[model samples]
Target chain A: MIEVKDLHFAYGSNPHDTLRGLTFHIDDGEVFGFLGPSGAGKSTTQKILIGILNRYRGTVSVNGLNLQNLNSDFYESIGVAFETPNLYTKFTALENLEFFAQFYGSGTRDPMQLLTAVGLEEDAHTRVRNFSKGMKVRLNFCRSLLNNPKLIFLDEPTAGLDPVNLRKLEALILKEKSRGSTICITTHDMHVADTLCDRVAFIVDGEIRLIDSPRELKLQHGERFLDLEYRDGTSLICTSISMDKLGTNEIFQKILYKYHIETIHSREASLEDVFVKTTGRSLQ
Target chain B: MRLLAALKQDILFQFRHGFYYVYAVLTVLYIITLRLLPETLVYPTLTIILFTDICTLGFTFIGAIVLLERGQNLTESLFVTPLRLHEYLLAKILSFLLLSFASAFFVMLGASVGGHDRMWFVYGAIFSALIYTLFGLVFAARARHVNDYFVKSLGIGLAISLPILAYLRLFDTPLFYVFPTRATLILLDVLDHDYALSEKLFSVASLFIWFLVLSGWVYQRFDKYVRHPA
Candidate 1:
């Protein structure tokens, strides 16, 4: 659905390019993520694809149209929910959606229905200024789905939501995935990247350090050790045994046979561990 | 249809923010101030009031709206949709033009019966509003906040309103003729007096050139400072 190659962008005042050379592709219906710390040019890359930042040195094509030549019609199939809620505070929630929905032709989701989907149907008539941050975030998310967009760009989509709403939002995103909508999310949140993205790109300093599926990366980076807890007389003994050649190792066999095992489990690296290890920087 | 919807929403937004109420009180103040003037002075005073109302004040008004929209980050969100920049600008222009027209009409009703060409006054109000709104749009497109808009607009406002010094005969210069504000005053003057065809054409032609120039400047600046601020 999207292709970017050798993307380089620099602010006018700054001679150094903020985005040095970014190359990536997002398949149709696939959830892709740009995992990076703040000021890592994640939003800048998204803006270029959305055609907001046009002064960039590279090829960025979205839905077969080059970002350089996209007309207003090109936005018909694309939706973006900015990190900050960009909404009219004076307008009611329903009014805000209806106002935006007018920009699209047909096939827009009903404003009230979208409100209900985000658990905000009751506050549809309330001014956005009265809404909580989570409510505004949900409303912003709902706006992204207004056109049943083929490609959706969500920046920090779950920033302000509580666990319940966060899960609900995750479910809604998965629903979008199920319906074959390609999603691009830029966030430092490892959990969001792991659960939502089909393929994740570790981007830092306007470059991609790595790109792969979360499960694959975890296995590649994990220690693959078998953690065992057993009772040795009155004391409990804990040990990590390598999974390599486990069946042939006499020590692994003896631990299971000689000692009363309290627990035995494999230790796997999480995406967070992999991210930190690969990037050599904290997500913070 | 989208333009109309945007126009309606702009007006609705301003109204909800009490702009209409502010206009109500401001329009009344204008009518009352005009009514107190002597009959001989009413037209000249109305011309001055309408000039300020439609031109200078419209400049400030447009600045306020754009600054508010920017503050709310609506400008960025707006461009993400299928709305063209020209359509968005047109909606803003039309909304403020209509407000200026309505306010002028009420002020005329409360102050004068007939001594002027009604349609000319309407045209004057709209044209002046368009010219000055575009003038303000240039500044607004670059302003970062409400105070930023107000401060920057003050200097540009004074610079553009310089033609008034020549109109009032305090400082007469042929250079003032180069300004669209000179053409704006001509349009307003046309409402109260019969002008030669050549004068009317010059007024119209000057405003046309200024409109095109200011509109282009505004579009470029808005595209730069607002759309691609990143």
Candidate 2:
């Protein structure tokens, strides 16, 4: 649904580029996670794609239309949730959604349904200033879905949310994907990407270091050994054995046949490990 | 439709923030003070009150709104919507213009019984408000904080209003006519007596010219600032 090539952007007269020749693509109905630390150009790339920052030097195409050629009509197809919840503090949660919903021409979703989906239906009439940070974040998320946009851009959508709300939000995002909406999320949270993304890209210093599915990245970087845990004479013991010819190996067979086994698990790398290895930098 | 929605939102926001109530109270106080003044001083007092209400208050209100939006990061979200720069700007100008006109009308009624021309007063209020609002946008666009906005706005406000003092014979020079507020001051002068038709026409024409020039500059500056801000 979105394609970018050779995108370069710099603020004002600053000689340094914030984003330098970055290229990536997001397919329709696919959840793509852009993983990066702070000041690593993640938000800059999102802003450029959403048409908020217009002075970039590159070719960006959204839904088969070049970014430069698209006008206000382009906004009708995409929705953006900024990192900070940009809401009217004095207005009610429902009022904020209703106000923004008027900007779209047609195919707008019901604000009440969106609020309910984010578990904010009870606080729909509450002023945003009186809302908690989690409530405001949920309202912010609700605003992006008000138009049922074809493409949704979420910047750190799960930040500052409790586990229950996080799970609820993640479920809503997956629901949107099921409805065939392309999603682009920029966050430094590896667990979110591991759970939700079909593809994840690790970016640092305005450049993409790696791009692949989370499962594939883990498998490719994982060890080919299984760790066996068994109890020997009232003491717990752990041992590692290669997968190759493990069934015929005498020690493995003896452990299974003779010892009281406690637990056994394969040794595999995690997405966070692969991210750190590839970028030579921590997600935090 | 979009502009109307934006205007409604702006007006609602202002009301919710108590901006309208504060201005209403101030207007009532000005009217009461005008009632206590000597009969000979009513015209001058009304003229000064209207000028400050339309020109200075209009400018400061726009600046405050812009700064508040920036602080809340609302403009960044608004930028991504279908709302155009001109539409946003026009909504602001129209909403504030309504307040400035209402305030000026009350002050006029309190000072003059029913002898003055109301149309000229409305025209002058609108023109001056538009000019100052545009100037406010320019200043607020460059200001990073509310404190910065206030300091810069005060300096610019004084510079713009200094010529009005000159037009009031405080400085007494024809060079004061070069300022746009001088045109507004001349229009207000009609409250005293029937001014020459040629001078009235020239003043009205000059105000329009200033509006056009300032509007063009404001549009360009706003478009650039939103798309690629400093």
Candidate 3:
């Protein structure tokens, strides 16, 4: 759904490029995450893809059209939720959605339904200025879904939300995936990336250090042993054993047959660990 | 159809913002003040009030709205939508024009001013308001905050309207005709007299030309701001 090659952007005559020869493609219906620290060109790259920022030095094609050549019709097929809540503070939640929905010619979902989906049904009539940060974030996400867009760009979509709302939002995003929508999210939240993304690109200083699925990356970078915890009288014993040939190993069989095992967990690397190892920098 | 929808939305938003209410109260106050003026002073007083409120104040109102939208990041979001720049600009101009006309009409009605061409008065007020509103867009586009906008708008308002005051014989100079405000002042001047066709045509032509030039400049500046905002 999106293709970018050799993309280079510098803000207003700055000698350093914000995005340096970045190349990546997002498949249709895939949830692609651009993972990076703050000011790591993640938002800039998303902005270019969404047609908000032009004058870059490379080809960016969304839905098969060059970003520079696309017009207002381009917006009809895509939706964007910016990092900051760019909402009308004075307007009610429903009013803000309705006002923006008028700009789309057709295929707009009902504003109230979207609000309800985000658990904002009760605050539909409340002015946005009175909403908390989490409420505004939910409303912002709701606004992006108004057009029922084919491609969605969400920047830090789960920021400032409590666990319940976060889970609700993640479910809604998964629902969008089920509907075959192409979703691209830019965030530093590793857990969100691991849970929601089909593939993630670890970016630092405008460069992609690594790109792979979270599961695949973890498996590749994780230790090859499993840690076993067992109870022995009043003490707990923890031991590690390699996975290879464990079925026929006498020590593993004897431990399992003789002692009660409390927990056995594989020493798998997390997405955050892989990201820090690969990029040589933290996601923060 | 989209333009109309956007226009409706903008108008509704402005009403909810209490812009119309505040202007309504001020319009009534101006009308009451005009009503107490002596019969001999009523015509010039009406002209002055319309010029100040509709023309000068219209600029400030448009500037404030634009700056407020910028602060709220509305302009950034609007830029990504299907709304064209000209449609957005026209919606703002037309909405403000309607409010300014209402103010002018109520002031005229309350003052009971007679012996003037009503159509000419309406046209003058609209053209003046358009010119000033366009000027406001230019200033608002460059301003970073309300205080910056206020300072710049004050300077621009003074520079433009000072010529109108001079043409009204607050100060004497034929040189004042060189400014665009001359066209508006001449339109107001023709209201109280049975002016010659040539003089009326000249004022209309001048105001139309000013409108075209100012609209072009405003659109160019506004488009640049939308594409590459500082």
Candidate 4:
């Protein structure tokens, strides 16, 4: 749904560039996560993709149209949820959505339906200035979906939300996924990136370090070992064995023959562990 | 349709926040101040002060709104939408201009009720308010500090006008003819006194031309002054 090739951007008057020859593409109907630490050009990439920042040194096309050539109609097909809550604080949640809804050619979702989608229906009439950070985040999410966009860009979608609201957001994203919307999310949260993303890209210092499905990356970098726990008379004893030699090894056979096999487990690397190993930097 | 909705929302937001009410009171008080002037004074001088005050108030409020939006990063957020920089700026200017015109109309309506010749007041108010508001936008776009714009607008307005007001005593002073106070002076010279209608027509045309030129400058450089989502 979106493609970036050799993308380069520098803040004018600044000495250094923010994005350096970055290339990536998000396919239709998939949740593509751009995982990186702070200052890794995540927001800049999203900004460029959403057509907010122009004057870049590379080509970016969304839905097959060149970025520079698209007009106001281009915005109608895409929804964007910025990392920061950028609502008009003086307006009620309903008013804010209604105001923005007028800018799109597509029919807008009912304001109540949008509020309910973000779990803010009860607070629809309250002024945004009175909302907590989580509440504002939810409202921002609702605003993004008001146009029923075919593509959605969510920047740190779950930031500042309570666990329940965070789960609600994850479910909403999945719901959008089911409805065939391409989503691109930029976040440092590996757990979210791991669970929600079908394919994830590890970006560091304006470069794509790796891009693959989480399962594939984890398997490629993980150790091949089995963890075994046997019941000792009053307790359980645990030991590790290589997966390759488990059947032919005499020690494993003896443990199985002489004691109760209490439990067995296999080990695999997590996205966070792979990220640290690849970048030599913690996600923190 | 969308642009109008956005414009209406902005105007409603202004009203909801009590700026509309505050401006209404200031506008009323200004008209009353004009009426309370000594009757011996002519109509033209009274109208000049009233219109100038109306224009100043409009400029100040519009500048404040723009500066507040800049400080809060509201403009940056709006830019992310389909809104062009020019559309936003035009909406703000037009909304303020219309509101200022309405204020001026009501003030002049009071003057009309008192049997004053308000035709000049109506024409002069529009010419003065539009010019001053456009001037205010130019400063508000580049002015980093709101207090600074406030100080600068008053300082510039007074510095330029005080000399002409002083020269009004010397009816033949060349400086009086070259300055905006000249416009006010010519109006004052004919207040209770009668002047040819041709003279009023000439000054009115001059003021209208001044307004048009200033508005043209505003429209030309408005895109450059938008600050690019900073």
What is the TM-score of candidate 4?
A: 0.84
* All-Cα superposition RMSD per candidate: 2.0, 1.7, 1.9, 4.0
Global CA lDDT of candidate 2, please?
A: 0.85
Q: What is the lDDT of candidate 1?
A: 0.88
The stretch of ten residues in a row with the least summed lDDT in candidate 3 chain B is B221-230
Which residue window of length 10 is worst by lDDT in model 2 chain B? B110-119
lDDT of each: 0.88, 0.85, 0.85, 0.76
Instruction: Let me know the TM-score candidate 2 reaches against the reference structure.
Output: 0.96
Residue B90, candidate 3: Cα error in Å is: 1.7
Docking class of 1: medium
| Candidate 1 local lDDT, residue B1 | 82
State the lDDT of candidate 1 residue by residue for A1-284, as single tens digits: 79999999998779989999999999999999999999889999988988999999989998778888888988788889999999999999999999999999767998898899999999999999999999999999999999989999999999999999999999999999999999999999998999999999998888888999999998998888999999989999999999999998798899888999999988778998988898897788
Instruction: Please tell me the interface RMSD, in Å, for model 2.
Output: 1.5
Q: Is candidate 2 or candidate 4 better by TM-score?
A: 2
Model 1 is docked with a DockQ of: 0.78
Q: Which is the leading candidate under lDDT?
A: 1
Model 1, residue pairs in steric clash:
none
Model 3, B1-230: lDDT tens per residue? 76897788778878878899988898889878878888777777777777788777888888888888888888877777777888888998898888887877777777777555766656777888888888888888888888898897887678767676565667857666656677677677566656677866776777888889989988888876664452
Runs off by more than 4 Å, candidate 2: A245-261, B227-230
- Score chain A of each prediction against the true chain A by TM-score and list the results: 0.93, 0.95, 0.98, 0.93
lDDT of 4 by residue, A56-75 (tens): 88999987899888676777
TM-score: which is higher, 3 or 4?
A: 3
Judging by DockQ against the true structure, name the best candidate.
1
